[model samples]
Target: MSQREQAILVVSASTDVIDLIFDLCEQCQEASLRLLVVRNTDEVESVLEHHEISLAIVDCSTFTDVEYLNQLAAHLSPMSTMALLEEGTAEGMVAVLRNGADDVFSLAELHLHPQLFIGSLQRQLQRVRMIEEVRFLRESLERSLDELKADQHAAQQLQEKLLPPPVRELNHIDFEYVLQPSLLLSGDFVDSIAINEYQTIFYLADVSGHGASSALVTVLLKNMTYRLVRNYNRNSSFDIQSPLATLHRVNRELLLTGLGKHLTMFIGLIDERDSSLTYAVGGHHPMPVLAQGGEVAFLEGRGMPIGLFEKPVFDERRIALDPTYSITLFSDGILEVAEGDSLDEKEQVLLAACGGKNLSPQSICDFIIPAGRVNPDDVAIMTVSRV
Candidate 1:
């Protein structure tokens, strides 16, 4: 109930009971309550619906029996206290109390103890003040939550723009990817960039944590890669197309940031001229699948994760590429939902899935992500292929 609209109901057939309450209100000026005098039961119900009644003072004598008082108390609004005026026996007093009367008074003793009526009114008003304060705090909390959601949504959009398109054609090699975040922002990131004419560099990275903190690392990763490419174009560096050198440079920059974050990455350079792929692994799992000539298998390599140790070592491995082949890379999150009971069993499931689908990112996503399913962790799928 609002502070300025606290109404109190007085239900009595005689004018004496009503007069006594009015005189008590005048004597107690601290609790300013609007007095609602109603003579009958029906009038009391009407006032309760339209007014925010704080307390209801009912006269048991006006009712036919104690049953009426029982029904009235049960039907009053929640948090509204009910008091009774009954100059009857102890049996009647207990009956009225069980019927929901917070306090009972002997109407005959009012002339001797006028203070009794004043004390009860003050207590009931105190309860009303507590209710109002709780309501105000609840409303304020809801507003704060709404504002936080809005900020997260805006950050999500900017993160999406930092990466390359979902599908791209670079250096005559087709690239496609699908990234699904567990939260409003994703820790998994993917990108493909062309260097010179015959070579293309592409990578998929998974940051250590899940939400906004991990997402911030992705932004920094993209910026560092962009700076590397800019330096190469200006002839200041040649690490962009070298998988081993690129990983070392990334490790050095990530350590300098001191963001307390680490990442597992699968980075590769595809060369169409020699029909070869040179790749390096940074503590990644479910290694990229090589599908060629009706046979599919995982490539080989493992190293310490980037951004972890001061001098993390990584080795670049080369594989002979066929004229028509597809290489698929995925974040470890893919294993969480893979069809298996253990990690080894899960790896087999993924190899089987990619082998069956012939290493298509779209086909892999269809088999992995359901129409309305939310994965427990961030999932990133990327495919570098040629027909």
Candidate 2:
């Protein structure tokens, strides 16, 4: 696993060939260059254990058979290789090169053009070093990619864990929710927190983007709402429990953080004693559907998205709920799934799906939303019903 020192490997017993390599190394002034000397194929593996052999110089006079030279060349590669033969066998260069030697040289050429021969060796060595460097960089990049994936996976698990159960109880009300993500990290989130024995505050928020940046905002939203609940429990603030005040608190915090993320959300407070739902809307589209009195209609409320402006104002809306009622809330991703040519057409389809009497959250979503879509936008669907 350890990276080895780069070197040239010369496989020969002849003192002339060995001396030629030493002379070339000195003539090139490669003071740090290391040479690995081996006499036979048996010694090749042992030398490889210590040095990263970049170039192999094989004296092919004893390996004239094409098949044997081919085998030798195969063993020396992917390191650059050169074949040396006796001067009279000039025709051997073609066979050696075709068999995969990067270059071929002769003892006669080295003697006649010493400078040119050294130049050729230098070029081959430079090429081999470049190949090794590229391989090392590729491995390092792969390791970095793996680490990023691991971190994203951990963040996704924690995000899923923070969600409420599919079926949650708060006095006379019940809550249900489902989430689908476009990627390893999602921008959509939903949760419920009990403000008191009789009041449960629930909301679904869709942050501006997908992946880690938006995911961090979802975590902030959860923490902000919890801090508000703690304030209510300590009797430090009552407005903290109101859906309108909660949106205002979140908007202020988001602006202060300067994270450049904003979200559209619908927060509701279910008062069991009054059989009423008090809620606030932060520019959430396809507003929460109210299914009561054997009919379905979109709740009427509008406001600026949170985290966008400094003096932003939102309104608190109230609607009386029947003894048996269901309120379905969806992030705008529903429109992406709803069949339509335009936003108006998609809204109509969403309304039609909710016409049934007393449909559960899962039933409403299952009817309107298709599953197994590739690269779907982040979606959070939630329903609060009296049971």
Candidate 3:
């Protein structure tokens, strides 16, 4: 049965009036009616607490004041109400409607014909059920969205744990980095690990896209890097320091599964003994300028990105590290910043940030990043310096 046709509630202030409604409710054939005689405002709250009242047939003859009627309307639920009125002015009828009554019934007409009252009450109850159903659905959707948001937050935290945190005081090298994700799970990833006592390796990679899918690929890359590093330690032929060979292996593995996947990456290994830095690029953005004494020089890569073409030649670039120079490896998101007058303008701003007399990696990043571009895509920046 419809919720409207299940049960009803009858409210009246006077004992005689209550008895009259109880008798009429018994006579009605449509649905069952539950009667509650509310002597005053004190009983309204108590009655509502225990009983699931659907429709209220309020006694309007005794509860005639606007304030009392308004109190009942305010305490009751919205969208389902039936007002009882005496044969009076049109203003009284309008007042009942303005107070949120679905329909106002005349007491005289109700006594003259019982069928009309039953039919009108039944119609109002049907409307009440419809509104209740909509309200139920809306609440359910809100709860589901809240749960999804909470799950996403948990996933983001787990993804962060997978990322390698910055290592402080790595022998003779001074480094700093920043990672800002556009979404809860970012596609950009960075890591720094020591290959041996004399060589420390670092790589910055941007997956093909953003969000959870790209984040999963980044986790896979990290695991692969870990496995390869271990292999290099155990065997002499792995060439752990060769960035090009690493990219080639990663590219082949990603393409084998036909995942339509690819990555832009820059991998670097620092030889602490001679301060020589060997690096390779995989279709990543051009390297940042190596800034020294207010001058800038290009550090361009000579290879295509990984996972695009098979047997792609990976070119490794090397530079002798200078205590006076800073080597920056960054994602395209920084260069793609939209607020600048031009790409040159953005580059100039970044160069100026690094131009500070006592600049650190964190300080330089903080200066160059505009407020508006803080997050729109994954932005990762890493700088390596010879201390």
Order of all candidates by lDDT, from best down to worst?
1, 2, 3
TM-score for each model: 0.78, 0.92, 0.81
Q: How accurate is candidate 2 locally (lDDT)?
A: 0.82
Off by over 4 Å in 1: 1-76, 86-129, 357-359, 368-374
Candidate lDDT scores, in order, read: 0.82, 0.82, 0.73
Ten-residue segment with the worst summed lDDT in candidate 3?
1-10
Q: Runs in model 2 with CA error above 4 Å?
A: 1-4, 29-31, 68-78, 88-90, 357-363
Show model 3 residue runs off by greater than 4 Å: 1-8, 13-41, 51-54, 108-123, 236-239, 255-262, 292-295, 307-314, 371-374
* Candidate 1 residue lDDT tens string, 1-387: 445656778899889878987887778655466889999887887887788766778887778777777777777645554555556578877888888887787776566676876776677677766776776777887888788788788889989999799888998888998888889999999999998799889999999998788999999989988888999999999899898889898899999999999999989999888989999998888788888988888999988899989888886899889998888899988887666678888787667767764446767877765566668888888988887
Model 2: lDDT of residue 192: 86
User: Which pairs of residues have clashing backbones in candidate 1?
Assistant: none
Candidate 1 residue-wise lDDT at 73: 70
Candidate 3 TM-score, true structure as reference: 0.81
